[model samples]
Target: MKSFAPKFVWFDGRYVRDSEANVSVMTHAIHYGTSVFEGLRGYWNSKNLNIFRLEDHVKRFRNSGKVYSITLRFTDRQISDAITALCRKNNARQSCYIRPFYFVGRYGINLHVTEKSPTHAAIVMFPFGDLFNRNGISAGISSWRRINDSSTPPLAKMGGNYLNSILATQEGKRNGYDEAILLDHLGNISEAPGENIFLVRDGKMITPPSSSSALEGITRSSVIEIARDLGYDTVEREIPRTEIYFSDEVFLTGTAAEITPITSVDGKPVGNGKAGRITQKIRNVYSDIAMGRNKKYSRWITPVY
Candidate 1:
Protein backbone atom coordinates (compact mmCIF):
# COMPACT_ATOMS: atom_id res chain seq x y z
CA MET A 1 0.00 0.00 0.00
CA LYS A 2 1.17 3.51 -0.74
CA SER A 3 2.00 5.60 2.33
CA PHE A 4 0.07 8.83 3.00
CA ALA A 5 2.46 11.66 3.74
CA PRO A 6 1.11 14.69 5.58
CA LYS A 7 1.59 18.10 4.05
CA PHE A 8 3.02 19.57 7.25
CA VAL A 9 4.81 18.52 10.40
CA TRP A 10 5.23 20.18 13.78
CA PHE A 11 8.97 20.70 14.20
CA ASP A 12 10.91 22.48 16.91
CA GLY A 13 7.86 24.34 18.28
CA ARG A 14 6.40 25.35 14.90
CA TYR A 15 4.63 23.89 11.91
CA VAL A 16 6.73 23.31 8.83
CA ARG A 17 6.41 21.75 5.42
CA ASP A 18 7.20 18.06 5.70
CA SER A 19 10.26 18.45 3.53
CA GLU A 20 11.61 21.22 5.78
CA ALA A 21 11.38 19.11 8.93
CA ASN A 22 14.87 17.79 8.32
CA VAL A 23 17.86 17.10 10.49
CA SER A 24 21.54 16.95 9.76
CA VAL A 25 23.10 13.67 8.62
CA MET A 26 25.59 13.97 11.51
CA THR A 27 22.81 14.06 14.11
CA HIS A 28 23.61 12.02 17.20
CA ALA A 29 20.25 10.30 17.17
CA ILE A 30 20.94 9.07 13.63
CA HIS A 31 24.23 7.49 14.65
CA TYR A 32 23.52 6.44 18.25
CA GLY A 33 19.73 6.30 18.48
CA THR A 34 19.63 8.67 21.45
CA SER A 35 15.97 9.50 20.92
CA VAL A 36 12.57 8.74 22.40
CA PHE A 37 9.13 8.67 20.81
CA GLU A 38 5.46 7.86 21.25
CA GLY A 39 2.60 6.84 18.93
CA LEU A 40 -1.00 8.09 19.26
CA ARG A 41 -4.15 7.51 17.26
CA GLY A 42 -6.85 10.04 16.37
CA TYR A 43 -10.27 8.75 15.38
CA TRP A 44 -12.65 10.74 13.24
CA ASN A 45 -16.37 10.09 13.52
CA SER A 46 -17.40 12.21 10.53
CA LYS A 47 -18.22 15.19 12.74
CA ASN A 48 -15.24 15.39 15.09
CA LEU A 49 -11.66 14.12 15.42
CA ASN A 50 -10.88 12.78 18.84
CA ILE A 51 -7.41 11.97 20.05
CA PHE A 52 -7.35 8.89 22.22
CA ARG A 53 -5.76 9.36 25.62
CA LEU A 54 -3.95 12.53 24.67
CA GLU A 55 -2.88 13.51 28.17
CA ASP A 56 -1.55 10.08 28.98
CA HIS A 57 0.44 9.90 25.75
CA VAL A 58 2.00 13.33 26.27
CA LYS A 59 2.93 12.44 29.84
CA ARG A 60 4.60 9.28 28.64
CA PHE A 61 6.37 11.13 25.84
CA ARG A 62 7.94 13.56 28.29
CA ASN A 63 8.86 10.76 30.65
CA SER A 64 10.48 8.83 27.80
CA GLY A 65 12.68 11.84 27.13
CA LYS A 66 13.51 12.13 30.79
CA VAL A 67 14.62 8.49 30.80
CA TYR A 68 17.25 9.35 28.19
CA SER A 69 18.25 12.86 29.42
CA ILE A 70 16.77 14.41 26.27
CA THR A 71 14.99 17.41 27.77
CA LEU A 72 12.17 18.81 25.67
CA ARG A 73 11.95 22.53 25.18
CA PHE A 74 8.17 22.63 25.30
CA THR A 75 5.97 21.97 28.28
CA ASP A 76 3.51 19.11 28.24
CA ARG A 77 0.63 21.51 27.73
CA GLN A 78 2.39 23.15 24.79
CA ILE A 79 3.12 19.81 23.20
CA SER A 80 -0.45 18.69 23.72
CA ASP A 81 -1.85 21.85 22.21
CA ALA A 82 0.49 21.60 19.25
CA ILE A 83 -0.67 18.07 18.58
CA THR A 84 -4.33 19.12 18.46
CA ALA A 85 -3.49 22.14 16.37
CA LEU A 86 -1.50 20.01 13.97
CA CYS A 87 -4.44 17.71 13.45
CA ARG A 88 -6.67 20.68 12.77
CA LYS A 89 -4.05 22.19 10.46
CA ASN A 90 -3.85 18.95 8.52
CA ASN A 91 -7.65 18.82 8.18
CA ALA A 92 -7.55 15.18 9.17
CA ARG A 93 -10.94 13.75 8.24
CA GLN A 94 -10.18 10.11 8.90
CA SER A 95 -8.44 7.92 11.41
CA CYS A 96 -4.79 8.92 11.54
CA TYR A 97 -1.57 7.95 13.30
CA ILE A 98 0.38 10.51 15.27
CA ARG A 99 4.06 10.37 16.10
CA PRO A 100 5.76 12.71 18.55
CA PHE A 101 9.49 12.38 19.05
CA TYR A 102 12.65 14.14 20.06
CA PHE A 103 16.25 13.22 19.49
CA VAL A 104 19.79 14.33 20.30
CA GLY A 105 20.89 16.68 17.56
CA ARG A 106 24.28 17.04 15.90
CA TYR A 107 26.84 17.26 18.65
CA GLY A 108 29.37 15.42 16.54
CA ILE A 109 29.70 11.75 17.50
CA ASN A 110 29.62 12.16 21.24
CA LEU A 111 29.07 9.12 23.37
CA HIS A 112 28.07 11.13 26.44
CA VAL A 113 24.58 12.64 26.29
CA THR A 114 23.03 14.77 28.99
CA GLU A 115 20.06 17.06 29.56
CA LYS A 116 22.24 19.88 28.31
CA SER A 117 22.70 18.22 24.94
CA PRO A 118 21.01 19.86 21.98
CA THR A 119 17.82 18.14 20.94
CA HIS A 120 15.22 18.49 18.20
CA ALA A 121 11.53 17.63 18.43
CA ALA A 122 9.01 16.84 15.73
CA ILE A 123 5.40 15.67 15.43
CA VAL A 124 3.98 14.02 12.34
CA MET A 125 0.63 12.54 11.42
CA PHE A 126 -0.49 10.44 8.48
CA PRO A 127 -3.76 8.99 7.33
CA PHE A 128 -3.46 5.36 8.40
CA GLY A 129 -5.67 2.30 8.53
CA ASP A 130 -5.15 -1.01 10.28
CA LEU A 131 -1.53 -1.74 11.10
CA PHE A 132 -2.06 -5.48 10.86
CA ASN A 133 -4.76 -7.72 9.54
CA ARG A 134 -7.62 -6.79 11.84
CA ASN A 135 -9.47 -9.98 11.06
CA GLY A 136 -6.47 -11.98 12.37
CA ILE A 137 -2.76 -12.48 11.80
CA SER A 138 -0.12 -15.15 12.22
CA ALA A 139 2.93 -14.88 14.47
CA GLY A 140 5.98 -16.82 15.57
CA ILE A 141 8.16 -16.88 18.65
CA SER A 142 11.22 -14.83 17.75
CA SER A 143 14.73 -16.14 18.21
CA TRP A 144 15.65 -12.67 19.50
CA ARG A 145 15.05 -12.12 23.20
CA ARG A 146 13.31 -9.00 24.48
CA ILE A 147 15.55 -6.30 25.97
CA ASN A 148 15.13 -5.73 29.68
CA ASP A 149 15.77 -2.93 32.19
CA SER A 150 19.05 -4.58 33.11
CA SER A 151 20.37 -3.61 29.70
CA THR A 152 18.84 -0.53 27.98
CA PRO A 153 15.51 -0.22 29.82
CA PRO A 154 12.64 -1.76 27.84
CA LEU A 155 10.04 0.47 29.50
CA ALA A 156 11.46 3.56 27.89
CA LYS A 157 10.39 4.09 24.29
CA MET A 158 13.91 4.73 23.14
CA GLY A 159 14.80 4.63 19.48
CA GLY A 160 17.96 2.54 20.02
CA ASN A 161 16.01 -0.17 21.80
CA TYR A 162 13.91 -0.88 18.71
CA LEU A 163 16.83 -2.58 16.97
CA ASN A 164 15.85 -5.70 18.87
CA SER A 165 12.29 -5.43 17.53
CA ILE A 166 13.52 -4.70 14.01
CA LEU A 167 15.62 -7.84 13.90
CA ALA A 168 12.81 -9.97 15.35
CA THR A 169 10.25 -8.56 12.91
CA GLN A 170 12.58 -9.14 9.99
CA GLU A 171 13.06 -12.74 11.08
CA GLY A 172 9.30 -13.20 11.35
CA LYS A 173 8.83 -11.87 7.80
CA ARG A 174 11.57 -14.21 6.55
CA ASN A 175 9.72 -17.12 8.19
CA GLY A 176 6.47 -16.02 6.46
CA TYR A 177 4.74 -14.99 9.67
CA ASP A 178 2.78 -11.75 9.80
CA GLU A 179 4.46 -10.67 13.06
CA ALA A 180 6.84 -11.72 15.82
CA ILE A 181 6.31 -12.38 19.51
CA LEU A 182 9.35 -12.20 21.79
CA LEU A 183 10.24 -13.82 25.06
CA ASP A 184 12.01 -12.01 27.81
CA HIS A 185 15.50 -12.90 29.04
CA LEU A 186 13.97 -15.57 31.27
CA GLY A 187 12.32 -17.37 28.36
CA ASN A 188 8.85 -16.18 29.38
CA ILE A 189 6.45 -14.49 27.00
CA SER A 190 7.09 -10.77 26.83
CA GLU A 191 5.23 -9.07 23.98
CA ALA A 192 5.05 -8.64 20.26
CA PRO A 193 7.60 -6.52 18.41
CA GLY A 194 5.58 -3.29 18.83
CA GLU A 195 2.49 -4.29 20.80
CA ASN A 196 1.66 -5.91 24.13
CA ILE A 197 0.43 -9.51 24.09
CA PHE A 198 -2.64 -10.83 25.84
CA LEU A 199 -4.15 -14.27 26.06
CA VAL A 200 -7.61 -15.27 27.19
CA ARG A 201 -8.19 -18.54 29.04
CA ASP A 202 -11.15 -19.67 31.07
CA GLY A 203 -12.75 -16.27 30.52
CA LYS A 204 -9.84 -14.32 32.04
CA MET A 205 -7.53 -11.90 30.24
CA ILE A 206 -3.85 -12.40 31.09
CA THR A 207 -0.74 -10.57 30.05
CA PRO A 208 2.87 -10.36 31.15
CA PRO A 209 3.88 -7.56 33.47
CA SER A 210 6.63 -4.99 32.95
CA SER A 211 8.91 -7.31 34.87
CA SER A 212 8.62 -9.61 31.88
CA SER A 213 10.13 -6.82 29.75
CA ALA A 214 6.81 -5.64 28.36
CA LEU A 215 6.41 -1.95 27.76
CA GLU A 216 3.67 -0.54 29.99
CA GLY A 217 1.47 0.18 27.02
CA ILE A 218 -1.42 2.63 27.28
CA THR A 219 -3.63 0.43 25.12
CA ARG A 220 -2.75 -2.56 27.25
CA SER A 221 -3.86 -0.77 30.40
CA SER A 222 -7.01 0.49 28.72
CA VAL A 223 -7.93 -3.04 27.67
CA ILE A 224 -7.45 -4.30 31.19
CA GLU A 225 -9.69 -1.62 32.60
CA ILE A 226 -12.26 -2.07 29.90
CA ALA A 227 -12.29 -5.81 30.46
CA ARG A 228 -12.74 -5.50 34.23
CA ASP A 229 -15.42 -2.88 33.72
CA LEU A 230 -17.18 -5.31 31.44
CA GLY A 231 -17.24 -7.95 34.23
CA TYR A 232 -14.23 -9.95 33.02
CA ASP A 233 -11.17 -10.59 35.18
CA THR A 234 -7.83 -9.22 34.05
CA VAL A 235 -4.42 -10.42 35.16
CA GLU A 236 -0.76 -9.51 34.87
CA ARG A 237 1.67 -12.35 35.41
CA GLU A 238 4.68 -14.03 33.89
CA ILE A 239 3.20 -16.00 31.01
CA PRO A 240 5.01 -19.00 29.62
CA ARG A 241 5.49 -19.36 25.88
CA THR A 242 3.36 -22.49 25.89
CA GLU A 243 0.38 -20.57 27.25
CA ILE A 244 0.10 -18.70 23.97
CA TYR A 245 -0.25 -21.93 22.04
CA PHE A 246 -2.88 -23.22 24.43
CA SER A 247 -4.90 -20.09 25.13
CA ASP A 248 -8.51 -19.94 23.99
CA GLU A 249 -7.74 -16.63 22.32
CA VAL A 250 -4.77 -14.31 21.81
CA PHE A 251 -4.47 -10.66 20.85
CA LEU A 252 -2.02 -7.75 20.68
CA THR A 253 -2.69 -4.12 21.60
CA GLY A 254 -1.01 -0.78 20.94
CA THR A 255 -1.75 2.67 19.56
CA ALA A 256 -1.03 1.35 16.09
CA ALA A 257 -2.12 -2.27 16.35
CA GLU A 258 -5.18 -1.37 18.45
CA ILE A 259 -6.54 -4.81 19.40
CA THR A 260 -5.53 -7.16 16.57
CA PRO A 261 -6.10 -10.86 17.08
CA ILE A 262 -3.45 -13.48 16.61
CA THR A 263 -5.18 -16.30 14.77
CA SER A 264 -2.11 -18.51 14.78
CA VAL A 265 1.19 -18.84 16.54
CA ASP A 266 4.16 -20.86 15.29
CA GLY A 267 1.76 -22.13 12.57
CA LYS A 268 -0.56 -23.47 15.28
CA PRO A 269 -4.12 -22.17 15.28
CA VAL A 270 -5.13 -20.10 18.28
CA GLY A 271 -8.59 -21.25 19.41
CA ASN A 272 -9.73 -22.30 15.93
CA GLY A 273 -7.86 -19.50 14.11
CA LYS A 274 -10.25 -16.57 14.25
CA ALA A 275 -10.87 -13.46 16.34
CA GLY A 276 -12.46 -14.64 19.56
CA ARG A 277 -15.83 -13.32 20.75
CA ILE A 278 -14.38 -11.63 23.84
CA THR A 279 -11.62 -10.03 21.77
CA GLN A 280 -14.17 -8.61 19.39
CA LYS A 281 -16.27 -7.21 22.22
CA ILE A 282 -13.37 -5.39 23.82
CA ARG A 283 -12.21 -4.11 20.41
CA ASN A 284 -15.69 -2.79 19.74
CA VAL A 285 -15.81 -0.91 23.03
CA TYR A 286 -12.35 0.48 22.41
CA SER A 287 -13.39 1.67 18.96
CA ASP A 288 -16.50 3.27 20.35
CA ILE A 289 -14.59 5.16 23.02
CA ALA A 290 -11.94 6.22 20.55
CA MET A 291 -14.42 7.44 17.96
CA GLY A 292 -16.50 9.47 20.43
CA ARG A 293 -19.40 7.03 20.30
CA ASN A 294 -19.25 6.29 24.05
CA LYS A 295 -20.08 9.35 26.05
CA LYS A 296 -19.42 7.63 29.37
CA TYR A 297 -15.69 7.51 28.60
CA SER A 298 -15.67 10.99 27.12
CA ARG A 299 -12.73 12.02 29.29
CA TRP A 300 -10.52 9.55 27.48
CA ILE A 301 -10.89 11.46 24.24
CA THR A 302 -9.80 14.98 23.27
CA PRO A 303 -11.79 16.46 20.43
CA VAL A 304 -9.72 18.23 17.77
CA TYR A 305 -12.52 19.47 15.56
Candidate 2:
Protein backbone atom coordinates (compact mmCIF):
# COMPACT_ATOMS: atom_id res chain seq x y z
CA MET A 1 0.00 0.00 0.00
CA LYS A 2 3.03 2.27 0.02
CA SER A 3 3.76 4.88 -2.66
CA PHE A 4 6.81 6.88 -3.66
CA ALA A 5 7.62 10.22 -2.01
CA PRO A 6 9.05 12.99 -4.11
CA LYS A 7 12.62 13.95 -3.38
CA PHE A 8 11.62 17.45 -4.49
CA VAL A 9 8.43 19.44 -3.91
CA TRP A 10 6.53 22.49 -5.07
CA PHE A 11 7.10 25.06 -2.36
CA ASP A 12 7.37 28.83 -1.79
CA GLY A 13 6.28 29.45 -5.37
CA ARG A 14 8.46 26.79 -6.98
CA TYR A 15 9.05 23.06 -7.05
CA VAL A 16 12.08 22.24 -4.93
CA ARG A 17 13.44 18.91 -3.80
CA ASP A 18 11.66 17.63 -0.70
CA SER A 19 14.92 18.01 1.18
CA GLU A 20 14.94 21.69 0.21
CA ALA A 21 11.24 22.44 1.05
CA ASN A 22 12.18 23.21 4.64
CA VAL A 23 10.30 25.68 6.84
CA SER A 24 11.77 28.02 9.43
CA VAL A 25 11.81 26.92 13.08
CA MET A 26 10.19 30.17 14.10
CA THR A 27 7.46 29.83 11.46
CA HIS A 28 4.13 31.01 12.91
CA ALA A 29 2.30 28.06 11.43
CA ILE A 30 4.77 25.65 12.98
CA HIS A 31 4.48 27.17 16.45
CA TYR A 32 0.75 27.92 16.54
CA GLY A 33 -0.63 25.49 13.91
CA THR A 34 -1.78 28.41 11.76
CA SER A 35 -2.13 26.45 8.54
CA VAL A 36 -5.02 25.24 6.35
CA PHE A 37 -5.30 22.34 3.95
CA GLU A 38 -7.64 19.99 2.10
CA GLY A 39 -7.77 16.21 1.51
CA LEU A 40 -9.09 14.84 -1.79
CA ARG A 41 -8.89 11.57 -3.67
CA GLY A 42 -8.51 10.83 -7.36
CA TYR A 43 -10.13 7.44 -7.91
CA TRP A 44 -8.80 5.15 -10.60
CA ASN A 45 -10.93 4.97 -13.72
CA SER A 46 -10.35 2.14 -16.16
CA LYS A 47 -12.26 3.82 -18.95
CA ASN A 48 -10.36 7.11 -18.76
CA LEU A 49 -7.05 5.63 -17.62
CA ASN A 50 -7.04 8.24 -14.84
CA ILE A 51 -8.68 9.19 -11.59
CA PHE A 52 -12.06 10.72 -10.74
CA ARG A 53 -13.10 13.95 -8.96
CA LEU A 54 -9.94 15.89 -9.68
CA GLU A 55 -11.44 19.29 -10.53
CA ASP A 56 -13.93 19.37 -7.65
CA HIS A 57 -11.16 18.61 -5.19
CA VAL A 58 -8.81 21.30 -6.58
CA LYS A 59 -11.59 23.89 -6.28
CA ARG A 60 -12.01 23.01 -2.62
CA PHE A 61 -8.26 23.25 -2.11
CA ARG A 62 -8.29 26.87 -3.29
CA ASN A 63 -11.36 27.73 -1.24
CA SER A 64 -9.89 26.13 1.88
CA GLY A 65 -6.83 28.40 1.59
CA LYS A 66 -8.92 31.52 1.16
CA VAL A 67 -10.79 30.74 4.39
CA TYR A 68 -7.56 30.53 6.39
CA SER A 69 -6.20 33.83 5.01
CA ILE A 70 -3.70 31.86 2.99
CA THR A 71 -3.86 33.74 -0.26
CA LEU A 72 -3.29 31.04 -2.87
CA ARG A 73 -0.64 32.72 -5.01
CA PHE A 74 -1.61 30.40 -7.84
CA THR A 75 -4.90 30.76 -9.61
CA ASP A 76 -7.43 27.90 -9.62
CA ARG A 77 -6.40 27.15 -13.17
CA GLN A 78 -2.77 27.07 -12.13
CA ILE A 79 -3.46 24.73 -9.21
CA SER A 80 -5.42 22.42 -11.47
CA ASP A 81 -2.54 22.31 -13.93
CA ALA A 82 -0.08 21.64 -11.15
CA ILE A 83 -2.09 18.67 -9.83
CA THR A 84 -2.38 17.18 -13.31
CA ALA A 85 1.34 17.67 -13.85
CA LEU A 86 2.23 16.06 -10.52
CA CYS A 87 0.04 13.03 -11.22
CA ARG A 88 1.53 12.59 -14.66
CA LYS A 89 5.04 13.11 -13.33
CA ASN A 90 4.57 10.40 -10.73
CA ASN A 91 2.79 8.08 -13.18
CA ALA A 92 -0.05 7.77 -10.65
CA ARG A 93 -3.19 6.56 -12.41
CA GLN A 94 -4.75 4.75 -9.52
CA SER A 95 -6.50 5.33 -6.23
CA CYS A 96 -4.51 8.19 -4.72
CA TYR A 97 -5.04 10.85 -2.07
CA ILE A 98 -3.94 14.40 -2.83
CA ARG A 99 -3.17 16.78 -0.01
CA PRO A 100 -2.67 20.48 -0.72
CA PHE A 101 -1.43 22.47 2.24
CA TYR A 102 -0.91 26.23 2.63
CA PHE A 103 1.09 27.52 5.55
CA VAL A 104 2.86 30.61 6.88
CA GLY A 105 6.49 30.18 5.88
CA ARG A 106 8.43 32.76 7.92
CA TYR A 107 8.23 32.17 11.67
CA GLY A 108 7.25 34.71 14.36
CA ILE A 109 5.05 35.20 17.44
CA ASN A 110 3.30 38.28 16.13
CA LEU A 111 -0.03 36.37 16.67
CA HIS A 112 -1.60 38.90 14.34
CA VAL A 113 -2.37 38.30 10.69
CA THR A 114 0.73 38.71 8.51
CA GLU A 115 -0.16 39.08 4.88
CA LYS A 116 3.42 40.04 4.08
CA SER A 117 5.13 36.91 5.39
CA PRO A 118 6.16 34.21 2.93
CA THR A 119 3.46 31.62 2.23
CA HIS A 120 3.97 28.07 0.99
CA ALA A 121 1.87 25.52 -0.94
CA ALA A 122 2.53 21.90 -1.75
CA ILE A 123 0.61 19.08 -3.48
CA VAL A 124 1.44 15.53 -2.56
CA MET A 125 -0.20 12.30 -3.78
CA PHE A 126 -0.13 8.90 -2.14
CA PRO A 127 -1.86 5.53 -2.47
CA PHE A 128 -5.41 5.66 -1.11
CA GLY A 129 -6.98 2.96 1.04
CA ASP A 130 -9.94 2.33 3.29
CA LEU A 131 -10.30 5.01 5.97
CA PHE A 132 -12.45 2.81 8.18
CA ASN A 133 -11.06 -0.35 9.70
CA ARG A 134 -13.73 -2.36 7.90
CA ASN A 135 -17.20 -1.90 6.51
CA GLY A 136 -20.23 -1.17 8.76
CA ILE A 137 -18.31 0.01 11.79
CA SER A 138 -19.91 0.37 15.20
CA ALA A 139 -19.39 3.95 16.44
CA GLY A 140 -19.79 5.47 19.86
CA ILE A 141 -20.96 8.82 21.21
CA SER A 142 -17.79 10.44 22.45
CA SER A 143 -17.50 12.07 25.83
CA TRP A 144 -15.30 14.65 24.14
CA ARG A 145 -17.35 17.32 22.43
CA ARG A 146 -16.40 19.40 19.44
CA ILE A 147 -14.52 22.66 20.00
CA ASN A 148 -16.80 25.65 20.14
CA ASP A 149 -16.83 27.93 17.11
CA SER A 150 -15.78 30.81 19.34
CA SER A 151 -12.81 28.82 20.59
CA THR A 152 -11.49 28.37 17.04
CA PRO A 153 -12.28 29.45 13.51
CA PRO A 154 -15.08 27.15 12.34
CA LEU A 155 -15.17 27.87 8.61
CA ALA A 156 -11.51 27.41 7.77
CA LYS A 157 -9.79 24.06 7.28
CA MET A 158 -7.15 25.31 9.70
CA GLY A 159 -4.73 22.99 11.47
CA GLY A 160 -5.88 24.20 14.88
CA ASN A 161 -9.41 22.91 14.32
CA TYR A 162 -7.98 19.41 14.00
CA LEU A 163 -6.66 19.52 17.55
CA ASN A 164 -10.27 19.15 18.66
CA SER A 165 -10.81 16.29 16.21
CA ILE A 166 -7.66 14.60 17.46
CA LEU A 167 -8.95 14.59 21.03
CA ALA A 168 -12.30 13.12 20.00
CA THR A 169 -10.72 10.55 17.72
CA GLN A 170 -8.19 9.45 20.33
CA GLU A 171 -10.98 9.08 22.83
CA GLY A 172 -12.80 6.69 20.49
CA LYS A 173 -9.68 4.70 19.59
CA ARG A 174 -8.93 4.20 23.28
CA ASN A 175 -12.51 3.03 23.84
CA GLY A 176 -12.17 0.44 21.02
CA TYR A 177 -14.47 2.10 18.57
CA ASP A 178 -13.98 2.85 14.89
CA GLU A 179 -14.75 6.58 15.28
CA ALA A 180 -16.25 9.27 17.53
CA ILE A 181 -19.58 10.97 17.07
CA LEU A 182 -19.00 14.44 18.47
CA LEU A 183 -21.72 16.57 19.93
CA ASP A 184 -21.90 20.34 20.00
CA HIS A 185 -21.72 22.56 23.09
CA LEU A 186 -25.48 22.31 23.53
CA GLY A 187 -25.49 18.48 23.32
CA ASN A 188 -26.75 18.19 19.75
CA ILE A 189 -25.26 15.48 17.52
CA SER A 190 -22.51 17.26 15.59
CA GLU A 191 -20.39 15.05 13.37
CA ALA A 192 -17.72 12.39 13.29
CA PRO A 193 -14.03 13.26 13.78
CA GLY A 194 -13.93 14.20 10.08
CA GLU A 195 -17.23 13.20 8.47
CA ASN A 196 -20.78 14.58 8.49
CA ILE A 197 -23.60 12.68 10.24
CA PHE A 198 -26.91 11.42 8.87
CA LEU A 199 -29.89 10.02 10.75
CA VAL A 200 -32.48 7.69 9.27
CA ARG A 201 -36.02 7.49 10.62
CA ASP A 202 -39.14 6.15 8.94
CA GLY A 203 -37.16 5.86 5.72
CA LYS A 204 -36.22 9.58 5.59
CA MET A 205 -32.69 10.89 5.78
CA ILE A 206 -32.04 13.78 8.20
CA THR A 207 -28.77 15.40 9.15
CA PRO A 208 -27.51 18.26 11.25
CA PRO A 209 -27.12 21.58 9.54
CA SER A 210 -23.85 23.47 9.50
CA SER A 211 -25.16 25.60 12.38
CA SER A 212 -25.41 22.38 14.35
CA SER A 213 -21.59 22.35 14.58
CA ALA A 214 -21.06 20.35 11.37
CA LEU A 215 -18.43 21.17 8.77
CA GLU A 216 -19.97 22.26 5.51
CA GLY A 217 -18.67 19.21 3.68
CA ILE A 218 -18.51 19.01 -0.10
CA THR A 219 -19.45 15.34 -0.03
CA ARG A 220 -22.28 15.99 2.42
CA SER A 221 -24.08 18.07 -0.18
CA SER A 222 -23.47 15.42 -2.78
CA VAL A 223 -25.02 12.76 -0.57
CA ILE A 224 -28.03 14.96 0.03
CA GLU A 225 -28.57 15.36 -3.69
CA ILE A 226 -27.97 11.67 -4.33
CA ALA A 227 -30.34 10.64 -1.56
CA ARG A 228 -33.06 12.83 -3.02
CA ASP A 229 -32.49 11.27 -6.42
CA LEU A 230 -32.87 7.87 -4.79
CA GLY A 231 -36.35 8.91 -3.63
CA TYR A 232 -35.43 9.49 -0.03
CA ASP A 233 -36.31 12.90 1.45
CA THR A 234 -33.32 14.57 3.09
CA VAL A 235 -33.43 17.12 5.86
CA GLU A 236 -30.62 19.19 7.34
CA ARG A 237 -31.34 20.41 10.85
CA GLU A 238 -30.28 20.06 14.46
CA ILE A 239 -30.22 16.36 15.50
CA PRO A 240 -30.39 15.23 19.11
CA ARG A 241 -28.36 12.42 20.66
CA THR A 242 -31.59 10.64 21.51
CA GLU A 243 -32.42 10.52 17.81
CA ILE A 244 -29.20 8.71 17.04
CA TYR A 245 -30.00 5.76 19.28
CA PHE A 246 -33.58 5.56 18.05
CA SER A 247 -32.86 5.88 14.35
CA ASP A 248 -33.34 3.05 11.88
CA GLU A 249 -29.87 3.68 10.47
CA VAL A 250 -26.92 6.08 10.74
CA PHE A 251 -24.06 6.92 8.41
CA LEU A 252 -21.14 9.33 7.89
CA THR A 253 -19.70 11.08 4.84
CA GLY A 254 -16.51 12.89 3.81
CA THR A 255 -14.16 13.21 0.86
CA ALA A 256 -11.87 10.53 2.27
CA ALA A 257 -14.34 8.11 3.81
CA GLU A 258 -17.12 8.86 1.38
CA ILE A 259 -20.05 7.02 3.05
CA THR A 260 -19.75 4.48 5.87
CA PRO A 261 -22.67 2.81 7.58
CA ILE A 262 -22.88 2.68 11.34
CA THR A 263 -24.67 -0.42 12.54
CA SER A 264 -24.39 0.27 16.26
CA VAL A 265 -23.83 3.12 18.68
CA ASP A 266 -23.02 2.91 22.40
CA GLY A 267 -23.21 -0.91 22.16
CA LYS A 268 -26.74 -0.83 20.81
CA PRO A 269 -27.70 -2.04 17.36
CA VAL A 270 -29.14 0.45 14.86
CA GLY A 271 -32.38 -0.97 13.41
CA ASN A 272 -31.26 -4.68 13.67
CA GLY A 273 -27.51 -4.07 13.45
CA LYS A 274 -27.14 -4.55 9.72
CA ALA A 275 -26.41 -1.95 7.05
CA GLY A 276 -29.62 -0.24 6.00
CA ARG A 277 -30.95 -0.70 2.48
CA ILE A 278 -30.80 3.00 1.69
CA THR A 279 -27.32 3.15 3.16
CA GLN A 280 -26.22 0.34 0.88
CA LYS A 281 -27.79 2.02 -2.14
CA ILE A 282 -26.04 5.33 -1.52
CA ARG A 283 -22.75 3.62 -0.81
CA ASN A 284 -22.99 1.70 -4.08
CA VAL A 285 -23.83 4.84 -6.05
CA TYR A 286 -21.01 6.82 -4.42
CA SER A 287 -18.55 4.03 -5.11
CA ASP A 288 -19.68 3.77 -8.67
CA ILE A 289 -19.27 7.50 -9.24
CA ALA A 290 -15.86 7.52 -7.60
CA MET A 291 -14.63 4.45 -9.48
CA GLY A 292 -15.70 5.85 -12.86
CA ARG A 293 -18.53 3.38 -13.25
CA ASN A 294 -21.24 6.03 -13.44
CA LYS A 295 -21.79 7.63 -16.82
CA LYS A 296 -23.65 10.52 -15.20
CA TYR A 297 -20.38 11.83 -13.73
CA SER A 298 -18.03 10.81 -16.51
CA ARG A 299 -16.80 14.38 -16.74
CA TRP A 300 -15.52 14.41 -13.17
CA ILE A 301 -12.41 12.29 -13.91
CA THR A 302 -9.18 13.92 -15.07
CA PRO A 303 -6.90 11.65 -17.11
CA VAL A 304 -3.33 11.69 -15.84
CA TYR A 305 -1.84 10.53 -19.11
Worst 10 residues of 1 by lDDT: 1-10
Question: Each model's C-alpha lDDT?
Answer: 0.93, 0.78
- Model 1 C-alpha lDDT per residue in residues 85-200, reported as the tens digit of each score: 99988888888999999999988978888999999999999998889988999999999999998988999999999999999999999999999999999999999999999999
Decoy 2 TM-score against native:
0.92
Best-fitting candidate, scored by lDDT: 1
Once fitted onto the true fold, the runs of candidate 2 whose alpha carbons sit more than 4 angstroms away are: 1-8, 47-52
Q: Write the per-residue lDDT of candidate 2 for residues 28-63, one digit (tens) a residue.
A: 788888787887777766544455566766676666
TM-scores of the candidates are 0.97, 0.92
| Separate clash counts for every candidate | 0, 6
Candidate 1 local distance difference test against the native: 0.93
Cα RMSD to the true fold for all candidates: 1.6, 2.1
